[model samples]
Target: MSFNSPLRDEELISKQVFERMVDIVGTSHIVANRREIMSMTEVLNRSAIKYDVPFRIATSGSMGEGFRFEESDMDVMEYPDGFQVIWDHSQNQHKSFSEGEIFVFDGSHSPPGYGLLQILSPEELNSSKLLFVKYGNSYLSSTFWKKTFLNPILGSRIHGPCISSNLECLDFDYAECLISRCWPPMASTFLSRCQLWPNPQTLQDIVNKECHLVPIGHKLGNHEEEEWMISFSLAEKALVYSMNHSQFLLYGLMKLFLKEIINKGLDEEEEILCSYHIKTAIFWTLQQGSSLECCQRNFLKCFWVCFELVTKWVYEGVCPNFFIPENNMFLTKCHGSAQRKLFCRLNAIYDVGPTCILNWLSMQDRSPSLYSYLRGNTNDLYIKELYNELAVFALPRYLNFQTCVRMLKSIVKSAPSNRDGISALVARMTYVSMLQHVAFQLMSLKKEDYTRDNNFDELSCLAIMQTAKLGSVSDLILRAMYSYRVKKYPEALFILKMAKVWLKQPYMIHFGYLDTEYSSEIAACPGNSLLEVVIKSFVFSIKLENPIFYIDELFTEQEHSRKNHWSTIFIPPFVLLLMLEFLCYRHVDTQRAQHALDELFDLMHSNQDSYLTSVFQDISWQILGICQEMAGNLQIALYAYMKSLVEPIVNRIRSATLQRIQSVKRRMCRI
Candidate 1:
């Protein structure tokens, strides 16, 4: 289970690969360039006082982290700290308002307090006025009203209320802007929720430090609107700085993978995966046990491990917010089926091994043509089309239509019993039909559209939408399979019921209804009858209390193989059974709860040690303790509670376990 191992190629090859990545990304150069930009901004701020420019520049994003890949945009904010206005009676016969009252001048012209208006040229003033008119009153703020209102008048040189610059350093470019706000302290609630590092004091100290927020506004269509987003760039920088050289190199490699390989050919319109996701993956990976040390030794292995973690998140349809676990980064940005397709693409890379990526990178070094071809013809193709193509191309060539037919036939031949045989055939056929449906739509695309970006994107989007219709059906089939395996007849029957509904109305993938044609095709599929029979049998068996007859019905020979793999698919039903027997049943069925706990523990032990295994063990122990406590077995319950505290994976869970232990001890004392 130790991921850290000595490099096989005497570290020479890995070192060269790392150096080549550095050459391509210039991550270090970006960091230095950002520092130079910060220095220049400071100087600019000092000089601007004479000209009455009231804005100061602050940095955020990858630049704030002190390292960015070649493609990263440096996020800058301009704060309107000390902006004011001057009124002159000689220029206009008008009185100025102060504190909600107008004051009249005594027929003599005098410069207003601070004489701030004297520094601006007439053209600048005119531009400012025109901008104010364009933006209207909504842009004004009470604290920096003059600066906020005058931002538009500042011309193209100013972005919003702050001066803007896109600096070029060592051939890398980053956008900088002045926004009218100072750094905001981190929210106390958010800080409290953060997963504490081993050294809680360090995390506490970091949270107490102030960090700037960018007035980039809320995100609209994955693009920031005119709202402020908290910037943790400085904290991110400190964390990265603390990493050893090897850890830093691996991070750079990950960035290179995201930018050069994964994001290649994605246009502005595409929901291109960002480097932030890769960084977040790294952050999570590092937090899990001693993964950082593992990465330092087995760079390639650890790189793939991190990639797998990212793929797992994508598969689960959730990319958790690194700092805040509750914030699902992918919820709004990516659809479930789309995320699955992404996982498939990444998994394909993994299946081919890291050497393939290294080889691709090497080929890129030798010739741009090879890289371009590998990047695919995205220029004329839509992003949707590109994704479809990636998913299609990533599929193994061996899995052809005939091969699929053979596989389905093999499932029928290897069925454990008559009942299991029928169920297996039905599930396999449904899967095949779904695949065939996708293939049919893909084939229907115009031949010319295959190469043209415009047509490809449109065609691809249609194909993917059609393909997405299968997700619900597929999910239900898998759920039912697990439920059946675990002998949860009622749960399995419920899942099958859901599957039937989805089969009838396949168009209802999300909130909206898809075209009737898609639903009609699914409804008309031949597997529906077989699916119905399996569902009916399950219902009858569950009612008769003859769950054992159907329980032995294994879906396919492959199910035997999956016995070794610990998955959430298995955990859900097991947990459901536990909850039903222990908490919801008319009588607290201690025997049934014990049975469920046993099965869960067995599954956990069968799987390799992992965070998930730890979680499973923790839950199993807690439930066992509960069962013992309810049965008045104080000594056994105390032992189970003590066991629950052993090596809990999640910090939050560990805290809960400690409290539970204390509760158990108090109860035992009372007894």
Candidate 2:
């Protein structure tokens, strides 16, 4: 039988929808593999932190769920370490953290999915924080947490439960939470309905994981100021991954629907419906034994089924939170006339049916829609976005030596399952390159046998192995940097000459690689060759977190720069390749050095192809200014520094830019 056996020939539109979805979001295995890779990255970063830090920071929400919606802020939850939320007072004897402060909660007064945190620790300890109110007991007020996050430095403001910060490239919403070790009694009933859907093992895992209490009280609740709403974020993330590819795609499509269709042109406060409502509807549908109903062939039917569920909830004015059936998610918004408005809108869209999905953007104001590609020939090639997304899986994670070792083992073990997938192959090459990085870092460390040739040979072997697999450009540039560092100018120059030749290849593809001729024929191609070049020839950046490759000239004044908050720093590969070119040639030949310097300015100033400045714009500009200063172009250096300052200031080297500006001004006065 054919794969579309469940779909009828008369249902041509449904079949097209299913195939288009496959092109938009790859095969189920591919999406699941990509999700695993992303989850692995977050886990590695969390583990890489110091053991004694008081807080545990994690990415939650849509970004962590492997979904990136436009303008949707990345959600990061920072909760107290050592313990978890929805915790029963009984688990205090777990002995894991018995010596530490214990925060028992009272759910008696608050609603089913919300609780009041009672500081069971010493009275003196609770006095210091001042976040507690004497409402019969020393209960923590979520209002206090709101005030704490309101310190305006940059463009940070309170957005619901989170403190939204405008980072240069990405906007982040940080929600401070308290973890409860035990599962909430309120959600205990949700497990009983799990028999048909989650399977025994997955259900057991959900029971074992911790839940959290986000700092927002139910607005209509009596203890509005103090109540902390229970969050099943940890459990939700697990459930989302356990979903079949069809379900995941439906969820993604539902999100797009909520954003583009339901909320289109509506002010934030005016849009009563939310993604959570849609998620709860899907979760209930899955538990009610509709899991198998979701399939690639009849996904449109499945989407409609889920949509009807939401419409029913809107009309009833009682959208149940999946975990705690008593927690009416629509309590505040979907009521009376508001409910009538939402129901009418969803009903009209329901009546229109597939046009709602296919004409999502066009129906609004004739804008381009995601389904526009579906209107074209399937074999006409647009690189099928999901695999293009897979390119990032090979980039190094935020890791140290030990974590890199663990990351390496994990990547290697998962290799067999991925088979011929581009991401898996790139991942294999990534682990080898990770070893090369470790060896390179070993060169910078002090060793008693510094004179021994063993370390050097081992390092050289790994470098050559990487060179053989993914071109010799990055490793060659790294070698030249080291050679120039130890005063081997002629050797460095020769290595760079080889690197320059390798660099001349047409730029390798990464995210946002193709220009706006995006729909034109130029963007239509790059399928197999794109994968081949990215795998075997592209210059993959050695993330600073990995510490594989280094040059002294790359750093700003270390002591003055507060780079700790920066999760990872991206200095584009081209900046390193050409910057070292300038340094190496300056020692050997003035004419060549001048030529390299000219190239540096061009790369920095030009917003052209061949180099991606979008990700590391500020850092690249800063590097150019540093090189200009070295060349005694003080005025031009100041101009370049100012350009770096103009970009977003969140993770960039702003202090270094400011200090350098002062240093240049002082030097100019001395002249």
Candidate 3:
């Protein structure tokens, strides 16, 4: 019963657990997940700017840290786009933030990790979003700022610093914040600690990045209204990114323990252990570096040590913040009766020993399910994860043309040492961006008679030749979509032919998971190579801004207003390319169109397969229905719409699919 550490004989179990963590961590997928989230948020901010939304949104917390689960709330921080906070009066001349109302950070009276924002620019400012905090010199209030995000309609309520909501499918938590370009003086210890982990480049990147002032005050502080908690969310994400697979898995397991065991056993109000406390423990453990034997062989031992650290923190009544050691994160909560209660709960679990660890890892459904992987064979897990990341890869808004150009310029201007081959995919996207910008210009000008334009013809040809540079099967498919859009049937046919040549090969070029018949083929795909790897990572996503870029199927959904149009609908590259072929052929050759339709039906029908994956399945089916309806096949369109409404898919498109079905029925009545 006195089990404080992994026993000598349990080393075998520790090794097996370590090996299991390897499968669950999915090494390449970890980097891909962070990259995808970062890129996705980048493009989302771009759309927000284009559409005039006031805040730049970023994913934060557990999901932002790169470990996602069914229960994980999608944590987002919304930094007001035009607002800036500077460290001192000397920075008042920092012209880079000229347009925004600036604030001088006043930390003198505030708690260790929190500060007050005093307006430095615009002697007089007025805005409804910020009116609650308006006082002498207009100091921003954490209490007022956090309340602004509340919405009774979305079932949203204040959850600490965030406005938590249960969206249709998932729970979302949005935290309002302001960005301070300079790192805080109190967090300088973190800079010295970075000498061990988070390489020089990553450290530099973290330092250069802005620190956010989240709408959270120290609960015990007097200035609750005006205090803002300093958030190093971006820096923390970078640290998580640098973690080895074992460390990452351990972090995830800690989260699991907090949720399934701790929270499940205690009442909602009594749930004393939070993920942040666990994260602090991990950070403290990680900073131990050479002292801690953090590897596969000692994974369980490391986990146990981290567990002991948490228990120790509870016993001593202090869990220090990772960045600022002066900040006791558990200041009021984990003391006296609360401390005793948490320690007892943890000690009882510790006594359960390997049994507790087994139970923790048993009911998994976080990323890919550690439960089943622990029990069943994992022959196809590698390929399965590749497909999972690829599916998510395609679901972000494509960087707008302007963003691509700016990003390309920034990369070019960066030191040669800073540039890497990863930029090649992005660099080529800049070329496609110019072509895209020109095509949009020509499309708008030649709206009525697009085919007659000589300038459009030149750009169209360039779009065709440069498609490969965009880096996926989307290379051909996006061009084919353009050709079809302009009624260039022969050109669409030529692009489809090239697409078919790529499709016919024995390759892992799928946007979503493949059928069961092809699962083994994917698992045996000879390492999936560099080219396929790039395609899997990028998935050759296309951004469709305005109704002009959308087919008739997606246009109707915009009736909900363009304000919340940041959603990037997931569509598998293979599904999209095939749908485009069907669309193109219907215009040029009835026989070919029918053949394409049949091929699509076969592919969709065989889709119960797990290993071969990606796409917004419902949208893909809905698009099929639209194509069928456009072709005057009312019955087929009706069936496709029905399939879309009923199918198990990622994002629910039920209402839109229902509308399409109703429309199809009305057309059938006409017949």
Candidate 4:
């Protein structure tokens, strides 16, 4: 046949066959079949148009490619309605009812007693005025009925007109057609049951067939294998059917199991197994339907299962712990479904990750599945973002300043984007700054028992302050250290005093070793000679000649050599005292200056130690004495100056004064 001829020939054959079909089965039934086909075609066409997908139709039975116009065969070239073929076969195709009759046609023939019998409901049989013909024992009703119709499926085979096969003598019915579609044991077993009938057995007889004797070995195959084949074939068919008509497959499967359950009244074990299989089917549907449909039709059943599972796990304490064995299984299934749907929606290939922060939060409000698990069901929201953001909501929560600083630092350091994450870090730092200010104000209050709980608030507040730079805290701490040197304990009191006003409680520090590394360095080098460079490098303006504040001064030459006796012990602390003094009061009033000089003298006398009185030291004392005299502590100031002049630089001091005195005397003589 030419390529185009096959098309023309198929059209010719289809027309001739359909006309013959109408003559025997009548035009009304053919029209009904046409209507059914049209409806299904429209559904397919619309879906194909919407998804922009190619369309292919396949047969639903074991007719292979189906007879020329078999139940499965459809002419789609001039589709959506009438044929344009020139040949009209309805009139001349069949000579009479018996010869060229289309009973299991497509060139296939039935035995004398068996042929195609139109299975009709009481209403259809009663209303139709179509002619009826006797074939075997069944009646082949005429096609031209008022309201009667034909269906492609009378259980299994497609019954469209002009369909036939090469087999000349086989006969069929719905059940036989159904059996023919199966392999081995099912077919033979079903046929054997029909053999027992007294009269000619038909398809209905096979459907109504029941078992009395045990199945034979060869007939059933290996029981396990048979069972496996049954389940496997069923699933294969379900998937194939699902590809074309998913809801129909679902309905069929659901109906079969439901009928089995109702008829057999499943025992406990069977009930569990049946329920489990049904549940599996539901999950399968969800997996497949995610892309095919929106699942609105599947919602009613899925919602019940989800609600039951979640509520059971949540309430009545069947599984008291948040995580339980059964609960995990259910959750896994749900999460799998969610992930599948999510993947489809994103059009992603590999398993996509979970919802983003915003999407998850939205789900919490809108999705019952999310709400049940996140809100009432389990404490674990599985949300990393919410926990990370908890610091924002937490209030009056005691967090040490060091802790606050550390947390903020970490947040800023790790953040990858210049978005919400960075903004949050900035907010934390601002809060810390506010806390520091409050802490300072509280310290300024200066209650007597500074260690009281109220005092702790101010210190606590300062502790929580977040800082991008360390310089601010460094300045405050250094000042506090000086105040401690002068016995101005209240000034240093701010360090721990502000805890009460703080948002969080303060952390306590237990003072340990008496000396630190910094202290040891200062003590080892007592004079400015050793410290000048370090001081300049650090740019800390401390003068060595200043009076010792917290430090204990010693006047012995051997003082540096002395071990840990009372006087010797004073050296390190006393030096620290002088540095503290410089730090607190770099410049002081004259009386206080003189008093500092007097304290040095007393210290020297008590120690019974004296060494080189440097010119600098003598001059420093003299200046202090003059400052005191200027302040009108004339007697004491004069005494201080006289003592200073009589010390190690005595001869120089006398000579200088005598020169000034002689100069005055000469001026008088001249007059």
Candidate 5:
């Protein structure tokens, strides 16, 4: 029994004989379900016709339960113009396979085009040229050509030819013809032209269409006993491209798709799709624990570019139909083109690396020392002026204050500079200050009326409190101005408390290393630090229903008697000031056994501190004015206080004011 079976001879025939059959029929007569594969087969058939290779198309099917296709047993006629297919039949078969003219017409097919092929020598095909491998075909090898050509195009293209299916069997010369022509033939070319319709607009579309979601079978004829067998491998390498349950691969492909979209310019709808895919890719990458640096970098780049483009559109007054409130101002007409122009000018700034931008805006610029960037030259006042200047543009949008606050804070944190630095900065903002000279300009825009908006008042108060931490002269001035604006006595008294804190605690004063921690003997004593006075003022301004508790831990642990007499003087004056200020404000509920002023008056007249008497008198007069609500009398009280503003021996009569004695005289006269 020869291994060279008669079935093999009947299967392939010769490439020359196949061409003669096709030449007789012409290209249009033979029908193929797929035009591209048909076109490819026709071209090979034409070549076979020219070369005189014997070939035949095999008509095959299993009549019983067993049905399979063999590689070498089946063949189809080939021609230079088109295929003249012939059918093959087995004599020993118990069951009948279909017998008819193998060239069955299908209505769907493309018009013919020129056919061409160039056969390579065995060395050429084995060398750099790619191979065309059929699973059941022994002649062909699984070489580069196979992967680059056969598998993607012809192997995937041909559907399993069923018993009654229009495409019933393989054309043997199809493989040989494809292999002989187009060395390193492009699989993409055949696959591309085989497309259903309209063609794939993008690479993603191509993958979506050609790659199968499930396993499919292929056909080749068996030589021995003229039978066919279906071959299944334990695992298929091509299954990677198949529709498997491996979601990870799909996700990877999606990311790859998004990367393609981002690199290639896309239209608006495409851009939106791109964003969705990119977002999903990000989530998938994270879920899969992929730490690819290239993936992250590309994602960031894509995100940043999209963000910038969207922002630019808004700036150009073409708001994308999306909910992006952050860009509302950019779309507003208040600044008109000015705002858009500004964005254009600042595009370079926005192009900064993500980390650098975040760090800079968040006041975390620790590199290059934040100070060096903020500190202007002896004459450079750009940053200082920025707060005031931006205040104007920001006010209309209700963002001025926040903008100013951020700018000033960042600038101050960026460098250590002083109140003069602050002043110079204001000089650059002369126009802005003029624009916002009155607080009502902005306050009028408050959602609540000024009187009804206690929250705003509280925020304003908080702003003042925080300003004391900055400790600039402008901050001090701003604090005073805000106090007058609110007309809340406790709010003003709180400033005195803050000022006391400023005098006693460590605080940064200037932009560069210009922090001050004032704790000399002057700051140590209650009188020297003026904490006693501030406390007294606070106590008088606030009407506490419960006895107010003081923190003992706040005071230094030094013995009282060991300190100076003037330090001791602070206790008496502070107590007297508290009682007198309260009496002035009508906050005191009762007269105690020991009058605060009298006790302090006795101490002052003892000459322990002569200046204390005059100070008491000034405080007394202030009490009188507060009680009377007399503007002129308040002036007189202010004069008295000013008179005793001396470094040492600051003095006057006892704590009783002339106004108090005069009030008694009036009552007595009435009696």
Candidate 6:
């Protein structure tokens, strides 16, 4: 019992205690089955779709990065797939056309005064629901009018000259639609304008891959069209994805500290900082040369370092966006009073030291009790029971399920205070259970007796039953699959159509209340549920191939408003439109084929944010060029081919366009 005893050595005691702490946290905190997490995520997507929640729920934040601890809240980002916000130019002050107003156009004039507008008689307008406008003394064909003027906005028609449709509108709603369609120039010019941090190349690649310019304005009173929030959630996820194991664990530890220790005492009225702010701090810290080795070598030191950075940001009331430094993530939310309170709390925590924190954590009911139980060498029966329960499902082949259960138990123990975290945990649990059920069903089947197809069918049915019980997206897809398998084409088509409607509702909700505070909460459904439904519908329709069935009505205008008075239609996914066009061509229905192509072109024109407009713009033009050539309009076809080669040249496309040009030239020579 001398003062120089080995147990009393300061360095030895510190190492022993901290090392045990690290082991306890690491064993319980780290994501063990990333594959299972991913698979379950996919299952969650299917479930979310089935429920018609428009937001595509994805694992994000610390939980996504795999460093999440028992007390760490889950971060899920909802990407709006079907919902798009276009710049509404008409709302920026524009002239409205009066009934019987006639305007002369030279075909080169910008909208409002540029394009030829023929005022249709009230009767004609009422009966046809079409703008029976004559351009340049010739009644413009419906195709030309649709291609040139009809810009669809949230199931409303925005019509005017193609160049300035937003400038003049017959209806207020139409004007808004027209203005929304004008893609913000800032989005395209973001790389050049904003001084992004770290590597511009890496930032640019992220922007190209997933960055979206949201209509949310940074500053209040700014024109909605002028203000677009450059979202970097995708970029941040990519950065998180690139983190090494140790670095991720450090992030997880920080998140746990924030969620449990920091935010715990804050009142509901308080402007509390979230896990995202902590993540932003970690991102900046890593950018400043904090490495995985630094984290591993000095875990607690790294934790304190991250905590210090977060405190500094909270004190300053300015947490900068990782990609765009100009974007202060905390600018709107973090107030002076809150900042001061947060700074004080952090400083107090720093002054108290690690031992105080450990003591404080141990006192909390929600803190991991397993560590304490182990340390006290008590609760032998309880620990044994827990181990036995886990051991029962701890099959090596089904390790993922066990990992999921461990994660779920940790999540449950954490007792998440937020709705999103709880929802995510529930979703994760549902997915794991569904997966296990399917796995069990498949395992029960004799591999030698059943073919692969039969095994697949049985597994699918099991999955369907599990998902269907929840009454979610996967259920609809499975039901459609069953219908298709049984050759119930029309029934399959109907079910798929219903699924598309469900997929689109979230976007519709978001679109309806663009000005509301909860707009951010309403996200378009992400994932390929709608696309999958469309493809399946197309397959079934093609198999049926009955013109009398009016398959075109279901396929072409699924999102069209049912009310006869409303002429507005949502722009259907171009993939469906493209497939329909191909089907029309296959069936030798030239009129419908031309109509489909025109609609596709109109859609491309109206939706600048559509993936079709960006990546597939050239392909769309090429298809249009070919269609025009077939229609014996060589000049129009040539113009389209040239347009396809216009900026953002794809090499293969250039070569193909040149070949088309030469062929057109040969045809011109023969003519």
For candidate 5, lDDT tens digit of each residue in 579-671?
332332322222421243344334333553312323334333333333332222334434433333322331222232343345545544666
Model 6: runs farther than 4 Å from truth?
1-32, 39-63, 67-208, 213-228, 353-356, 362-671
Off by over 4 Å in 1: 1-16, 22-53, 61-69, 82-205, 216-227, 292-296, 362-671
Q: Rank the candidates by lDDT, best first.
A: 2, 3, 6, 1, 4, 5
Instruction: Quote model 5's TM-score.
Output: 0.18
Computed on alpha carbons, the lDDT of every model, listed in order, comes to 0.43, 0.67, 0.64, 0.29, 0.28, 0.44
For lDDT, the strongest prediction is 2
Ranked by lDDT, the better of candidates 5 and 6 is 6
lDDT minimum window of 10 residues, candidate 5: 540-549
* Worst 10-residue lDDT window, candidate 4: 78-87
Tens digits of lDDT, candidate 1, 1-671 = 11134553625445445555444433343334334334433332333242344444454555445454445555554444432222233322352222211111111111111001122222333233312111222221112432443333111254432444332121112222222122222234445544533246656655554454333332332222322334455556556655555566677788778766666667644544677788878777776644345432366677777888877877777787655464566765566666766677777877887665554553247423322422552221121222222121111122333334444354345533544333333333334333433343344456864765456435433533432343334434544543444455566556655654544443332212234444344333456543342232111000001111112211111132123221111122233333334332213344654654554445434543311234345555655666566656667777776776684332124445566578778987887
The backbone clash count of each candidate, in order, is: 11, 6, 7, 35, 42, 14
What lDDT is reached at residue 340 by model 3? 90
Pairs in steric clash, model 3: 512-613, 512-614, 513-612, 513-613, 513-614, 514-612, 570-616
Q: Give the per-residue lDDT of model 6 (tens digit) for 1-671.
A: 01234463434433433444444344332233432344344453443353344445444434344442443223333443432322232423453432222222122222111122233223433334333333333221223433433445432432221121111111121111111122233345445543423366665565555433322334332222222243455567767666655566666666667756887777755746876677778777877765534434466566677877887887888787655565577766677777787788888887876533354352233444455645754433232232222221111121232343444344345433543332343343344343443433343445685675565656655654554344443245445544444445556556656755653443222111222232233222234332232222211111111111123223222122122222222222333434334334534556766665665556545663422435345545765666667667798789878887783532124556667788888998899
TM-score of each: 0.37, 0.77, 0.77, 0.15, 0.18, 0.37
TM-score of 1: 0.37
lDDT of 6: 0.44
Report residue 47 deviation for candidate 5 (angstroms). Answer: 93
The root-mean-square deviation over C-alpha atoms between each candidate and the true structure, in angstroms, is 25.7, 6.4, 5.9, 42.3, 38.7, 26.7
Error of 4 at 146 (Å): 85
